[model samples]
Structure formats: structure tokens, C-alpha cells
Target: MLGLIGIVMSSEDPNNTDQKTRLEMLNDSVIKLDSFIEDILNYSRNTRMGVVMEEINFEEILEEIRNGHKFMEGANKLKPLVEIIQKEKFISDKKRIIVILNNIISNAIKYRDTSKEESFVSVFVECDSKKAVITIEDNGIGIADDKQEKVFDMFYRATKLSNGSGLGMYIVKETLEKLDGIITLESSLNKGTKFSIQIPNQTN
Candidate 1:
């Protein structure tokens, strides 16, 4: 799909207004399809395998996630603060963790509050010998009070802004359960959303 996007973009003519609009639409469609396929693959991989216990490098993981999203459209408009206050040997399923973080970060960019003067997404990780505490917060178009509980259900979508495969959070919840982790959500409509996560270090 990305290859297709590149081909479509390269063929665009600067003088053709309708062609530019159509090209943008085509590009967006392919991107969404690519995302949906990736989401499905992630879900399948998590369910098929056992959690691999390994030491997770918080700083490296955060940097990788940041770089992955930098090419996204609204990502540049948002002020992002990602910090690791304390990091020790935090062991968990690295693949599952990346899937979880990627889905959450992707949503932050997708559902940004266009009405606001500025948008922001913050991620902080604190870890000890036993567990890791991760907080992902974003000032975006937040989940509604009524839809919060269903966000982790299969094929459920909380916001209309969702162009996702609807399996992202469901996969997150499933993966957390496999790792004996806990996740809590707090949000106000049109205000913002925050996810607080506590995952035990399997090395113990």
C-alpha cells in the first residue's frame, strides 16, 4: 500500500487541482488499508504466541515509536513530551508492548482536536525492580463518557474519528491480560484522554 501511495503521489501534476484532491484521497485510502492490515497481523501474532520475557529498553522503545509517527500528517502539529523518569530492568513481551503503544499513539494523532490552537500528547514511563508504570495522555477529541467501557471490546469503536480496524484496543486489552497487566482510562468528551498502565516485570 505504501508503494502504491508513492506511485500515486509521484504521478501528481501541480497544475491540476482536481487531480491533487483525488490523489490525496487515494493516498489516504491506501494508508488506512495498510493500517488495518497491520492491525490484523498484530492481533494474530499476539494471540498465537506466548509472551516472550525479555528486558525492555524504555528509552530505545520510546524513540522508535516517536520516529515511526513523525511522518504522520498531524504529528508535527502536536507538541509531544515523552520522558522516562526511571528505568531499570523492565522485562515483558516487547512485541506486544510495541503493538499496544503504537495503537495508542496512532490514535492520538488520528483524533487530534482540530478546533484547538495547540494539540499535545505525552508519554511517561516509570519503572522499578518489580513493575513498569506507563502513562499516555493526549489533549485530543476524547472518548465519550458512555463509550469508554466498550473501547476494549472486539470490533468496538469509541469515537466517530475511528478509521481503524476496531481491533486495536481489543488487542491491547487481550495482550495486557496475557501479561497480567492493568490499564485504566480517564477522559472527558472533547477535552482529552489519559491511559494509566501498570505491568509487572516477568523476570521476578
Candidate 2:
């Protein structure tokens, strides 16, 4: 009886309980911090690596981007709808182009309203003889006017709670600028954000 009583007292000790709970919480936080670091590394690698330009089919790129988001939604048990309007093909780095679309659309889906079942994302592409324009728009929560520019800054999260490294738009900006392209954003809080990139067909 005394042995059993001693074990019970040891288990019920306030210091031991507090220490066990603290360790568990710290372990969970460490796991989360590790994940955060990995994400940062991946984002940095994507931005730092350069690709060679080639004949890239705009439709195919759109499809690839759509398929990627679809897979993500499926994994997260969410339904994603993607719409694309393409007018022409552009000559650019296929991988880089895919990166731009994928990152932006992923963020859109990530920020989508979880309370709503009919959430969807849209992508549009247009082109002329000189420049090709790609636009990605989402129906999720939008960015504030003042935060629009900050969205393209490295590690700048428009909202701290957002599930992104904040490097998506920054990478997009760098990649487009490398291709002599420009990105513009039009957004309003609660309305959604639209990112449009215009790249020259020929770098002369």
C-alpha cells in the first residue's frame, strides 16, 4: 500500500505535471519551427536558381498550374476551381513560369475562406505581339492598399497568420524582372487580390 501511495504522489506532483506539459509544448513548437525553416529554405532555393528560356506553351503551363492546385486541394479536403483565359504562347523559362503561377495560386487557395464551401480561384493570360500578360486572381480575402507593395517584399507577410513564407510574390517579382517583366496588383480587403505580370516576348 505504501509503495502504491508513493507512486500516486509522484504522478500527482505539481512540478512533475508542469514540467511534462512544458516539455510536450516545447517539442511541438520545435517541430513547427523546423517546418518553418524548411519552407524558408525551399523558397530561397526557388528564387536563387535561374532557368533558361524556351518555347513555352501558355495553355500547358496553365494546365500544370491548375493540376498542382487541384492536388493540393484534394490533399487538404478542399475543392478548387480554376479558370484560365489564354490568348497566346510566350517564350520563357518553363519552370520559372510554372513557379510564378503555382506559388500565387497556392497562396490564394491557402487563404481561401474555410467557412465557405464554394471557394474558387481564377487565372487569365493575354498576349500581344510584343508582351505576354498573365493574371492570377482569387476570391479569398484581399490585401489592403497599403500592404500591396509589402506583399512583394522578402519575408513580408501581409498578415502574420497567413500560411506562407511571404516569399511568393517576392520571387515572382524577381523572376519577372529578370525576364524584363513587370507585376502589378489590384486588391481590396475582403474582395481578393489580383496579380498581373507582363513580360516581353523578345528580350531585345
Candidate 3:
């Protein structure tokens, strides 16, 4: 269905303004459907796989997530404020951690409060010999207190601002559990949201 919609949209007459606008909306829907499908597949795969913990440089992962080519355009516009208070080798599933960071960071950008004079995301990392704690805070339209607890549930969407598959947070929580990690959230309606993730450090 999505592929058919894309083909129809692509073949539309560019001179027809009304048709163009409708087609654009249809295209957006198709893109979202595609994302939803991908997220479901990822969630299933990660759930079935065993965690492969390895020594990884925490800062390097953050750098890749913030400045990576995939996010360069959005990061440039969002101007996320990332402060790595501690950078060191940690033991965890690198890929899963990246997925968690990417989803939260992207949500911060996607749901930014345009009403604010300035929109920003701040990331703080703190770790000890036992575990690593990552706090991602965003000055974006926040999750209402009533809805906060459900954010990690599969197919749960907190706000209309969410465009992608509602599976992002679900995947994050499931992946963390696989890694023996946990997450918590704090938010006030219209204020912002903060997510704190803690993963056990298995380094010897």
C-alpha cells in the first residue's frame, strides 16, 4: 500500500497545486509506514538476540551519534548541547546503546517546543566502576505526567508531535532489559523531558 502511494505521488502533475499538496501528504504517510515497519523488525530482532557486551569508548559513541553524517543536518539546526562530563571505556552492547541514544535525541529534535525562544537538548554522562548513567534532557514539548509511564509500552505515543513508529521507546526499553539496564523518565507538561539510562558496567 505504501509503495503504491509513493508511485502515485511521484507520477502526479507538478503544476497542480492541490494535487501536489495532497500527494505530499500521502508521501509523508508512506514514509511513516515504512519507518513503523522497520522499527517492528528491529524490536523483534533485538529481543531474540543475546547481548554481546564489549569494551567501548563512551565518548566516541556520543560523538558519532551527535556529529555522524546521518544526523549532521538535524544537529546543525537543533544545535543540541552535549556535555560529556566523563569519557572512558565501558562494557555494554554498543549497538543497542546507539539505538537508545538515537531515538531519544531524534525525539528531542522532532518535538522541540517552537514556542520557546531557544530549543535545545542537553546530554550528561556520568559513570563509575559499576555502571554508566546517561541523562538526556530536552527543552521540548514534554510528556504529560499521566502519559509518562506509558511511553515505553509498545505502540504507545505520548503526543501528536511523534511522526515515526511509536515503537522507538518500546525498542529502547526492551533493548536495555536485554543489556541488564534500566531507564526512568521525568517530565512536566510544556516544560521538557529527561530520560536517565543506567547500564551495568561489566569491565573487569
**Which prediction has the highest lDDT against the true structure?**
1
Which candidate should be chosen as best, given TM-score against the real structure?
A: 1
lDDT of 1 at 122: 94
Worst 10 residues of 2 by lDDT: 71-80
Pairs of colliding residues, candidate 1: none
TM-score of each: 0.94, 0.70, 0.83
lDDT of each: 0.87, 0.68, 0.81
- State candidate 2's TM-score: 0.70
Sequence-dependent TM-score of model 1: 0.94
Pick by TM-score: 1 or 2, better one: 1
Q: Write the per-residue lDDT of candidate 1 for residues 90-114, one digit (tens) a residue.
A: 8898988888888898889999999
Question: What's the distance in Å from true for residue 94, model 1?
Answer: 0.9
Cα lDDT tens digits, model 2, 1-204, are 323434555576577877667555655555446546745664676658775878777777767766655534332543444444444555777776776777787778777766665666777677665787777777677888888878889888887556555666777777677777888899888777788888787633
Q: Which window of 10 residues has the lowest lDDT sum in candidate 3?
A: 68-77
Ranked by TM-score, top first: 1, 3, 2
Write down the lDDT that model 3 would get.
0.81
Off by over 4 Å in 2: 1-51, 73-89
